[model samples]
Target: MKHLTVVDHPLVQHKLSHMRDVQTPSHQFRQLLRETSHLLAYEITRNLKSGTREIDTPMQQMEAPVLTGRRPALVSILRAGNGLLDGVLDLVPMARVGFVGLYRDEETLKPVQYYFKVPEQLDQRQVIVVDPMLATGHSAIATISLLKEAGAKDLRFLCLVAAPDGVAAMQDAHPDVPIVTAALDKGLNENGYIYPGLGDAGDRIFGTD
Candidate 1:
């Protein structure tokens, strides 16, 4: 799993357990997702470029580290992805935001792009593509392809839970892009849902269905 990263922090794991419970309400579910996204953002940005700048402290002058280069961009895959986006944005308030709306076709289980928008100069900035679930990977792959065509070079995929099938599909399609996820579950069940996975993230997050 060289391209895969499972965030196993105690706090993340604990929150994830709550999110998986069938009895958890939509409000609580969204809260847990936000809290968990904060942790995931921290892990994903651990290696972000930084530079030192001189600053005057209350006591004396000193040098402090600050993020370098253009602020990183967060591209939400839409609907469900927005859940993670809210939390990431809380941490990276200055990050350029983008949105790519893709819905899965029930018959084909393929991604259909209905909306797509991203910041300019994507090639010059690191981009984190966010979504709550990586089930079949078709949507992730299609979205990444779209980003690449639009000039995004450095990209990473973040998700709350992923199925092995989804991870494998992403690896096959975009091996260069690392995947950061909370849990890599057994695999997808028929109908393309991750097994032992928390139910549909969009419905849970938005109080729909």
Candidate 2:
């Protein structure tokens, strides 16, 4: 899939192994997720545009390369997505933060939006959408649709882990948006959960269950 990128960095793979264990505690799980997110962020933004600007260092004045475009927007798919926001923010502290809160409707198995608040100039900057898991893909698709309706142009998706089904669905819906994920697990189970996946990211991250 040209739109997909699975990060195979040794650190990312190693931390993800620990994250999959049922025995990993909530605090430890959250810590590993944050660390992994930081690594993924590094790879996702590696090609960000840069331009030279004059600057005065402690010793001398010279032109140095710096990010040239408008600061990016980091849009977190709420609750679970918040788990990765800390690490991403650590890397891009100046990025505009946005939230899209969606919950699944049990009977319909569709995502319903409860909240959405994004930066004003979404059309002018690159937008990175963050979520811990890409499961059924409905939420991601809906969130991206909402952002586009609100005028977001460039967009990318970041996730801790994704299932093949979710990846397929996302690719079909938004072919131009690239997906950066730590691991691509087997297909989803009958219940729409990724098999061999870190169970219930929201619950695990918050110690809710």
Candidate 3:
């Protein structure tokens, strides 16, 4: 109950509602995911490092506050996380992208990394990790560790819906990092799925099943 951070922006709330509806088409669902990311990105990057520069407008020359350095990197958690990349990218089109593929190990109940590719010199840049469902948190927890090894010191975790258990795991393991989510559902089920969850994100988004 305490670990979740719900994003209550009207646009985010509206899109999240559509995202939960089963009738949403794959195309629309993907579109909504990207749009929601824009809203969520607003909250996560509210404190993005920026600098003021003197620039000339059509009318006159004045100091303007612009984003510092390049756009924040979008670090997708692979599979389902990709669904969120488009939404966030719509807001930060120039942001560099990265991917990490992790699957669960049944016996260990931990994330097993299959692949991870981050932008070069990520240590100097802020990173936003995107995954639609935060179910068990094993993947997010392990992914954060892996990201740190790759020199990602400044990181933010973003999810569409997070279970209480997953949020706790994330908060407990990575208290330094902030989590931004649209909805914080009740809890996880016996199969380690968030109750009333949107089901398998990758499958739902990609229509594989």
Candidate 4:
């Protein structure tokens, strides 16, 4: 996988347009995100390794392809990551799930970790970190570092939208992890929000804003 992959599939772009709309309601926004996540999941998991297994069919015995390795781990970056997590889980029903809780400090525009939990054998399984937005990348960088400390080696970062600054920061901090996003928007605002991004993904998803 490349350092960055923008999933530009038609359906993903279409749903993202609605998500970016300020007038979109929480219920509708949540539905769109769930739908869009499926598409993004397709791209992010494209390179997973597969092997063949011999099985008997009604007609004859033949080899059938199946995923070969241990189940991949889906690590959600708390709150907003849950929205994407649900959809991805729908697709990969057997995937292991985990969470890292962090909130940005408004004054310093940095992430502060509050909670962390992840499945065991991280070094043996592929870990994909999910979050809705990558505005400053502070939370993502911090979360990935913790995962590494916990023995996670193979990892990926998935998001709905990303700012150049965030992408660059991730690349600089963790060059080995590939980043997969639905869209890379114009950049960050003065307050560190991605410009034209679906504002406060947590708020929009929960109707708190």
Candidate 5:
């Protein structure tokens, strides 16, 4: 079974387990999202670009590596994605943040874009698009397509939980952008929600209907 990666870090796994429980409240759920986002941020940015420069340390000059180029732009895919934004920013405080708002229509079952914005000169910056769950994947693909149209060349997608169908959809749609997800669960249920998913991410995070 090609299951999505459930991150091995003890803290990440523990928080995720808590997030999966139905009894978790909105406040704590949001807090968990922030914490997990930071943990995942560590894994995703491990190979980020940096440069070495001479630094003086009391005695003599020493080589030190500092981040190179621009701080990557972090784009959150609307309401649910915002939950991840807090955590990611904690890890990369210098990263510029942007947002794309797209919601799936219950009746049509298609993504609808109500808002979209990205930092200028996205082409020169690496962009990390974030969301808690990769369910149907329409929103992620469409958001990426929009970013591509806006001249974003470098891209990565981050999610906490993903379903097999969504991963396949994203893989087929974007072979260039590698996905970084913590867990790949069984599959999507009939309504296109991930099976055993921590319920609706947006709803859970926002305490909405």
Candidate 6:
């Protein structure tokens, strides 16, 4: 993956547009998110390495390409990340699941960690961190830092949307970790929210105010 990837597939864009609409209900928003996530997962996993394995078919024997190495680890950045995680899992059922719980301090716009758990042998497998929004990028940077500390070397970040500031911050903090998002909006608002973003993803998905 490159330093950044924006998935502009029509289906992804269509669903994202609906998700951005305030009129869309929670159930519909959740459905759209799951559908959009599948498309994003396709783009993110496009570069994964593969090896061939001989298998006997009904008519003949042939070598079939299979994903190489251990199953990739999918680490959700808690709460809203679960929305994306659900759909990604539908695509990559074998992926190992993990979570890092962190909530932002509204006053400071910094991440505060409360929970962390991940698969073993993180150093060997590719780790993909999922979160819905990259606003200030504090939570993402902090989450990736912890994953690195846990021995995750090959890591990638996935989100539904991103702000310019957040992307820049993430790149500055963790240049090696590539970011894949549905859309990169203009920038953040005074309150650290992505402008024209789909509002609070967790709240929208869960029907909270």
Q: Which residue pairs in candidate 5 have backbone atoms (N, alpha carbon, C) closer than 3 angstroms, thus clashing?
A: 5-182
Over 4 Å off in model 5, which ranges? 1-6
Q: Candidate 6: give the clashing pairs.
A: none
Report every candidate's CA lDDT: 0.95, 0.92, 0.86, 0.94, 0.87, 0.94
Error of 3 at 51 (Å): 0.8
lDDT, model 1:
0.95
| lDDT (10s digit) by residue, model 5, range 117-203 | 889999989999999999988989999999999999988889999888888888788777767887888888778889887999999
Q: Candidate 2, after superposition: displacement of residue 175 in Å?
A: 0.3
**Runs off by more than 4 Å, candidate 3:** 1-4, 106-108
CA error at residue 155 for candidate 4, angstroms: 0.4
The window of 10 residues in a row where model 3 has the poorest summed lDDT is 1-10
Candidate 1: residue 206 lDDT (0-100): 95
Candidate 6 residue lDDT tens string, 65-140: 9999989999999899999999999999999999999999989999999999999999988899999999999999
Most accurate candidate by lDDT: 1
Reference-based TM-score of each model: 0.98, 0.96, 0.93, 0.98, 0.95, 0.98
Give the TM-score (vs. native) of candidate 4: 0.98
Query: For residue 8, what is the lDDT in candidate 1?
Result: 96
RMSD of 3: 1.8
lDDT of 3 at 97: 95
